[model samples]
Target: MSGARGAWWARIPEPVLDAVVVVVAVVDVLINLDDTSGPAWAMATLACAALIVRRRFPLPVFLLTLPASLMLDIVFAPFAALFTLSERSRDRRLLVTCALLFAVASATPWPLDDLSSHERAWTLVYFFYTLATAAAPVLLGQLVQARRDLARRLVEIEEAREHERLLHSQAVLARERAQLAREMHDVVSHQVSLIAVQAGALQVAAKDPDFREGARTIRSLSVDTLDELRHMVTLLRASGGRSTELTPQPTLADLHKLVTTSGIDAELTGELPPDVSSTAQRTIYRTVQEALTNVRKHAPGATATAHLWHDGDAFGVTVTNTPPARPSLPLPGSRQGLIGLKERAELLDGTFASGPTGDGGYEVRLRIPNRAG
Candidate 1:
């Protein structure tokens, strides 16, 4: 109900406001006036006209109303005009003006006839008290407005800061993903190119039966590796497209291809747990890939053993290889594959470690917690 009235009041025009304030002020003067035939009534009416622009020019309103209030006091009229003047012109600057007007007006003779000194002092006290009362509402309104504006500004700043942080994080993640894709492309492209070149040479040397058989095996491994690598690239592209591409994730089922491509003889040891799911399976596969790549590059003549063991809540994989007895040939490429695998495992709250064993063999170990736990 009050809201409806406020909405109605908002549609009132400036001209209407001028007419209303003048009417109210004139009514107030006439209601309390004992005699209404002098300069006091004229001054009061002029003061009402001056109040129409109080919001735009409060200082002028203060000046106009102060003198009018003094004139009203001189006419033996009630002192309500001074109180009304203070109500109309009480802001930060106008409060000081009002206090000054009160002090100056108190020094003059009262409109009351033959007043006692005590009665005069009481009237002066009443004037100051009225000025204080008028200042209370304006000061409280200003404080409430300042607090509400401050809270609104703080909320806006926090939302903007959070948006900036999200954008920065997305940019960093995009850069890292692009770098990883580039590295994978370089590694796969090099290995595939080598296999293709070697296969072409073997086809030419087919007359030499012994060399031909070895070349055929290399060719086969090369073809299979290329197919797998292409599938991986497709999967990356598709998943990166919509993130719902359900091209089957690699699992322990593909372990044989890894061994064959590495050109290493691996003796598998244990059974994979029934509960080993997508995440752990991928981690294991990548670990084997990295280990075998290192074996082919660094341990050329060494044999590797791939083992998987499941006991209770933890599952483990070990890839151990006897290193080349002779001086190590230059290891090909930057060896960041195992480092990346370790980081992947750690992100899933697993453990991974790889280094040379005391018995002149390289060993890579990984342990992942089972899902049932």
Candidate 2:
């Protein structure tokens, strides 16, 4: 509650605060106005009024208040001015000098009459007392200044920490993108290479003219796809340092194009609900892609079907391929594609399974909760 009141007080206008200070100083002077001469009253009034501009000209206001301190018993005007000066000034020597001047002014006798030895000694003692009293405002002002400095420094430190967190997050994202590029080059490039080889062989062996033409088209598409993949890999690898255009991310809507250009006899069936998130759509698309690529690589001359289905609380895709009619190629395999797909499924709180079916065919399945959206 005190903190809230302090904040409310801080919101008060500066001019109004200065006016309040002046009024308080005048009241203090009036309270101590017993037996004061005309000149003393005039100086006290001057001191109180000078406080109106003490924030802008603290040293001048403090000097104006010294005469009043010397002639009258009032303290509020001079101490207020001294505190203002101390808070704003960084020069320690100047603050010490002003403090000493205030002590001398307030302790010395107003009239320039000769003082007796005892009176002079007592005046010296009073000077020390006044000097000690002056230190309170100066020290309080310095304390407030230090508190403000510490608050500002803490704000700057927090901003630096926030910026560091942002950089760290970006670095982590860049590393993930680089890793993704490596996976695409390793897995997708290998599948497209197999498609090119198969098309070339089919083109040479086929007797029908239309078969030869289709093989040529397939081979041409495979080469073009390899080129695009190479470009995409280059962009993804360089994304850490500079901006680069990336290929559009695949979604359910692009499943038809993916199945058509997959360089295999694959059929896509069924549809997911329209409310699925982009992340889920991309995950589903990648699942089918990897499943189809595996069938072309490991099950030659086989027909594959991708079925998308959703139950009350879950959705998924299953890709099933018949047994190969021809012997599989002796293609190298690292099995990283399936591992990546499994990891992707787990990240979305889903499951992935792939194994040979009872009919000597292979089936890959992915199932995710609807909340994965």
Question: Which candidate tops TM-score?
Answer: 2
Q: Alpha-carbon error at 326 in model 1, in Å?
A: 78
lDDT of 1 at 366: 89
How high a TM-score does candidate 2 get?
Answer: 0.60
Candidate 1, residues 132-151, lDDT tens digits: the string is 65455445544544444445
What lDDT is reached at residue 226 by model 2?
94
Write down the RMSD of all candidates, one decimal each: 26.0, 26.7
Q: Highest lDDT, which number? A: 2
- Note the Cα lDDT for every prediction shown: 0.64, 0.85
* Regions more than 4 Å wrong, model 2: 1-6, 209-214, 241-373
Once fitted onto the true fold, the runs of candidate 1 whose alpha carbons sit more than 4 angstroms away are 1-23, 73-115, 172-373
> Which window of 10 residues has the lowest lDDT sum in candidate 2?
240-249
Candidate 1, residue 24: Cα displacement in angstroms equals: 4.0
The C-alpha TM-scores of every prediction are 0.39, 0.60
